[model samples]
Target: AGVSQEFDLSQCVREPIHLLGGVQSYGALVAARRGDAVVDTVSRNAAGVLGRAARDLLGRPVTELIGQEQWDRARESAEAVDVDVDAGADPAATDSGAVARQDGPASSGVLPMTLEGVDGPRLFDVTVHRTGDLLVLEFEPRAEGGPFVFQNFYPRVRRALQKLQGASDVTECCAAAVREIRALTGYDRVVAYRFDGRDGPGQVIAEDRSEGREPWLDLWFPATDIPPQARRLYARNWIRVIGDVDDRTAGLVPERRADTGEPLDLSASVLRTVSGYHLEYLRNIGVASSMSVSLLHEGELWGLIACHGDEPRRLSPEVRAACEFFGIALSLQLAAVAGREEADELARSRRSLASVLARLTSGASDDWMRPGSGLVELLDADGAVLLRGTETVEAGAPLPEALPGLLANLARRGAVGEVWSSDRLPEVLGLEPEEAEAQGVPAGLLLLPFNRDGDLLAWWRHERPAPREWAADPSRPVRTGPGGERLTPRGSAAVYRATVRGRSAAWSPAQRVVAAELWREVSGLLTRQVVALEARNT
Candidate 1:
């Protein structure tokens, strides 16, 4: 019996396979037989340039496809030779200087040749070599004018989307998006901006800057920077791609036949260009090009995805399309997060109200008043003195010596449910004058209203540490030796100004959205807690 044969994929191909090879460099597979046929020819970007599927090249013949000129050159070359084929040149129109002379061996280095594909006759770099019995011709794709021939978008895009999906919150989502954008385009800075309120109070909430370079980190800009008109336009149009910021903004000449007579909304999209003001703004910040993706929720502009590069940049059309799709996915996540925050705020408010009611009915106890009480801690303040009838509370150092008689005079006048500080003795008490002692009041009276039974009720006060300007700026520079000294005010701009002067602020719409969401959630919680407590008591 004949030995059984098994198909071995590696054995079938002349060249070793590299399945996990990085696509950063260009490569091709070429196989062809002498005279009769070309066995197989394949390249990475077959569909993009050749306009044919690589699978079609399998088992194909050379004479049946490539023109006479390429076949003739392949036959003559004794060893591998690089041949330049220009499809743009007329085949019949040969140059008399070279082809006209019928140069010896056709100048082995770069013989002119042409190829024929399904789309029609094409051109390529054909390397011819003699393999004893059958002549082999290797074909490499010719570079084209569009996107760089070597870019492998599939894996890059997949990785980007995977990263975006892993983000948990809006901040992380925007941050992830910025990081991906930087990786995709090699830009220097990326930012996220969101509207603060419906009235256009937006700000930057996140930024991803190049390492070791001083980026405008944690800086804030006024809403006027994006103007009402810009905000309204962004709300309507979900995204805008600015190919070249410094490029002229003239509309595509003759108008887009598909969009003719529509009075194009320039703000919506300037296609291939950007507005002068926007360009100048980007330039001021040292960015030469930018692309922004609008994040929207409930028909409102939630924020923006900004990609900024130091030099003029033009992203591949495919990349732009991919980014747009990714932006839409991000918008959905933003909406979901916003909805969750709203629900959380409502729940927090209800809880706070319940707590307030419980405290007001039985009177607030020492347990709640002990934390962060400012100077009130020194007075050994009791619960009644902290929560007594009052809209707010204030406390500071002990009162002056004459204040005891003054407080007595005011209390005798029936100043209902009010507390006042005093340091003087009251003679009407019928005791020898000593300190105007009142509950561990700490050399001062802990004022609280006496209930109907003249028992201590509630008091209110708030005191905090003295403000300091030494560490104010988040970007502030510090000089340290044996004794450290602050170099500037604690301001992001001041810190930036000290380092890099007059640079445009680097912020964006996505950051604002994430921050707005955060601020809204925090403020909503505080409001709910306070309102809930008030609601219960009232």
Candidate 2:
């Protein structure tokens, strides 16, 4: 029943995964109004998990199920989490991985409670959070146990933090992270997947896996693998788990809420049932169970600590929380490493810039276009150009003769005296494919017009021949499910090799700053030249 027609990848992005009206059967959910504490919604399996009738659950105070004191503590814990998030508190500030006695709360918003049931009492670790106007409490029964302790995972995570913080570079940091995650989770494989940029393709930079497993250590995955909607959820939630892809989901009672006529928004629910397409995708990849711990930086979904198990595996809520804590610490360490690298790069750039400036200042003439000015190598561009009035002078590789006309059109669009750039220069200039190729057009352009009259310094980058390796053919990203019920993006294991064209390496923020600084110097030189010429004429 696989799709025979061209696949529409947009369907994946449009799926409202968070509004799915079910929860994983391993846990049961109960929701009550935050203002009134009146029970309004519960998963159909809530009665089975709580050992009470579903009818008896609704229209009662939430305190009836959870004792009044635990209820207050849950609310207080949720509010504390909210405050921490709002203030952007350091992830290390709260150690959710701390071990506790079986009778005590494992972490904030997670506590053990024995609820009265039809037959004696059942102990569960209750996870509490708020979604919209509702207070949601999800209950997962504890494994038959003696004294439960988070000792195993807590120490591993603590060790992981030490390694992450001590690492001097991103490569070392990521390698240490994956190694610790694999050791802590016992997954067949663990990898750190880093996105190229916002919503861009990702690559598995580092991996720790079983000897028998195929290496995905450096494989690249298209952004479509995790669609935009999924990215939004990952940015909001720190952890997501799928115990068994084959298990049927427990339906939510009434499905949609009576007030909004919409399914429960489980954006923050740890046990929320996931997209069927995602489940099928995991199965295709030979993963029976999986977990993703979001790696965030400055509130953005930067990457993920992804784990895969060959057989169905379920982790206790405590284990998952500990993993989440490790992810947070790793993110902070990543930021520190990146900041240090950027600072070093800036230091080097300043040294080179000062050298270039000294040469320009010592010159007998004001013209910085001279060979020793280093303008050609300043931005690592393939070529550089100086354009004034109607004249154009170039160095290094040749630029399109029509480039001057293109710049005039750009100025007409009001880019005068402003910095402008594009990695896909031909496309931005509105040239057709044939036209661009025939003209041997550069793929990137950066312009700094010193004044509104359109006199400018320009840099161009030639089309870089880059061959990419995608997990699958990006054009065939989806196919109808076996039963033609859903669209899935996974099926083939063969890597797709493609040569990407019409684009150049992107300019970084530091390069842009350098461009601006250069512009100020250029403007001063031009002003002095004009004043000297006028003085001689007078």
The number of the candidate with the highest TM-score is: 2
- Estimate, for each residue in 187-284, the C-alpha lDDT of model 2 and write its tens digit: 99898999977677788889999988777877778778887677666766678899899988988877888887878777678789998878988987
By lDDT, who's the top model here? 2
- In candidate 2 the C-alpha lDDT for residue 4 amounts to 53
Cα deviation of 100 in candidate 2 (Å)? 35
Query: lDDT of candidate 2 vs native?
Result: 0.75
Which lDDT tens digits does candidate 1 get at residues 1-538? Answer: 1123322322212211111111111223333555566543343334444454555654576455565666766676644442211211222523221111111211122233455556776655543444323343434354355332335666887788788778777888888887887777676777787665553334456777777545544454444345444554455444555555565432221122122242211221213233344555566556777778777776666778777777766555455555665677778877776667666655654444344334333533332233343223323332223223342223333334343334334444333343333332232333233332332122223343343323222221222112212112323222323333222222243332212111112222332232223323333444466699999999
The C-alpha TM-scores of every prediction are: 0.40, 0.87
Q: Model 2 clash pairs?
A: none
Query: Where does model 1 exceed 4 Å of error?
Result: 1-155, 199-201, 251-263, 266-273, 354-538
- Model 2 lDDT at residue 533: 90
Measured over all alpha carbons after superposition, the RMSD of each candidate to the real structure, in angstroms, is: 26.4, 6.3
Error of 2 at 231 (Å): 1.0
Candidate 2 has its poorest 10 consecutive residues by lDDT at 97-106
